[model samples]
Target: MKKSLEKLLNKPLPVDPFMPQRAVITDIEELAPDHKKFSFAFCDESVNDSWNHIPGQFVMLTVPGAGEIPISICSSPTRKGTVELTVRKVGRKTEVLHRLKPGDYVAIRGPYGNGFPVGIMEGHNVLIIAGGLGIAPLRSLIWYILDRRHRFKEVYILYGTRSYEYVLYKEELKRLRERNDLKCLYTLDKFETEEDRRWADRKGLLTELIPMVELEPSETFVAVCGPPVAYRFIGKELLKHGYPESQIFVSLERKMECGIGKCGHCQIGYKFACIDGPVFPLWDTKNLPEMI
Candidate 1:
């Protein structure tokens, strides 16, 4: 626990919060339609060697001339050295990033946001729910827990996507599905082909899959990331099942510019999502105005 505690991303903070570190794109894999998984290594070996972050933290990536955007780190801290970011082609910044090739350079700052407190989650059953691109950050937490499976009890991964074609990490999810240690369930909104039906364990909204989990409500900690509209439904579903609001965490999607919270673009109530969150207890959603 001491070693893990020492590695928390909030360690004294970086000397220069605004300075971007140069990193080279090592590999690029097409994850889904308009989405790509990028592998990066810091150009300075010292920076790479010193890097450490929790599961739900994100980085501010510069898209050369276009601008910068915050993206979640999809790689587990357990697998150090090379970092991974799964980006979807959405707006101007991401559009430019999609055109980059392997070996091209990019600048990034952060490992930002208050990440999931995995330490507290240890010794309890884990419920991870993801929808659409929300799986990006949850992927990091999934690997972190999987890599140290002994620390936790039963683990369940419930992921829902629009269709088979839009599901990211197809091969990786297949491998996880084959594993005996954890339960992996998937749902799809539609099936375009016979293969799509075969891939999905169920068909419907992600909320529909929640009722199927059989864990003791008090002994589990839930992490959810998905469409903002889905939060209220999911929160109610979990509460209906007797899970405590304090133990349920959600990674929020906010338009954060300056990762240090000075930009004020990601304000939720009085708190800034960039520094205070991006990851917050499910209870916050209820107390905070317009949170969901």
Candidate 2:
């Protein structure tokens, strides 16, 4: 019996190898004042291929002289051929990326980090919260859920920006809100004019609107992405409403080099933000330093 068991365990198992290679930027589009979207296709057609990424996963982008940075996959898996990323021009790498146009070449490392818990979120109401550039990553999960709307109970999206002019995906948000299957809300810190106020749906911080929204804590799962300050405040409000820590997912931003966990730049405690997570359960690392 022992010999038979050993023989079974020794049998070869099939696995797919990870491919890391150069990809060319086939398209680039401006999304907001400081944000741009880049589209890539594999340079080596036979070996390097388009990525298979779960919502919330990110890729490390490298330019020869500028260095590398981890940017989230904003495009949905439902889209084929090319993958897209929305980058805000806030740092050296991004500024370099912003200067590059279509036909430029860049190195792509991975679709790293654990993604949103789609399997667990299925059948539960989803409440997505995004602020500023945070929408770049959360857009993936939102598209995934929208692609298979019937699989979930209800979907609600609340997005906040510093001003009306800073909102991302305004047209897309307006279209999605029209769908009876989903509910969407847009808020700003304050309105700039009477015309802006007429179009503005919600005002004040997003956390303020959270209290008035109707949701069943037991049946709902919340996903939040934003700057560190945004997470600190919104997280506290979510907890106050009795949302379990495990049910709250957050995407953290950090400096990253290699997206394959080979570099220590993105490390937080013992966790590598690029590999172990960019997305983590709120309670999983709530006690870890710099996690907030």
Candidate 3:
């Protein structure tokens, strides 16, 4: 491991962190009514081949006239040459992004934030809990684990959205549900119609699934990403199940400007989300009462 780190540190990066590289949209897939996935390829061959990022990290996507926003990299580094972003049209910049088409160019920089620690997670069972769009970032970690399946133990995924229509990655989740190696359970908050009940595995608050996960707390690592409200409840549920704060990891959503830590937009206590984390062990962040 040390030798690999040395080799990586000795290597030269293809693109500077501060300079935005030209990336062209290669494909676009609408995941939901408001959410879409955009795939990009660097116009420069060198960067396209050498750019690497760990799961849970994010990139600063430029929207030209609208400005830049920090977006989680939904694609894993194992998939070379292209990067992907799953975005929802919620604001001005994103609204502009929604209008983008294949062949259009955008400036991109990063692969920032301290991503999840995959090395420490090796040899342990992993429970991935995502609520709403939280799956966007967790999706990267999920694929990385699946690609290198031999390193980890049992894997379980529980995802919850407001309704069946709001669920992202429908086709991909369907494929995962059919796999024998892992478990996939999806739920909806409001299953008013018969069609909703037929599509989802269950219906209720995502926290309800905690008791259903059958893993030894000591041997499992739980990675959670969701709304701030979900974190408060989920943290308590994991504690009740005997998982230490250290064994639980949470991704906090923050407003970020200048993806590097210069702007204080993403400050939590003394830590900067852009630099210190967007991902932090619950033990590390438990003291920051305001953040949760």
lDDT of 3: 0.90
lDDT of 2 by residue, 13-120 (tens): 221224456889999877779888889887755323334688998877787689877788998877766878998898787788899989999987677889898889
Model 1 over residues 106-130: C-alpha lDDT tens digits? 9988889999989999999999999
Candidate 2 pairs with clashing backbones: none
lDDT of 3 by residue, 59-97 (tens): 999997899999999998877879999999999999999
| lDDT (C-alpha, whole model) for all candidates | 0.90, 0.80, 0.90
Q: Candidate 3, which segments miss by more than 4 Å at Cα? A: 1-13
lDDT-wise, the better of 2 and 3 is 3
After the best TM-score superposition of candidate 2, give how far the Cα of residue 146 lies from its true spot, in angstroms. 0.6
Question: How far out, in Å, is residue 180 in model 3?
Answer: 0.7
TM-score of each: 0.94, 0.88, 0.94
Which is better, 1 or 2, measured by TM-score? 1
RMSD of each: 4.6, 6.1, 4.1
Cα error, candidate 2, residue 253 (Å): 1.1
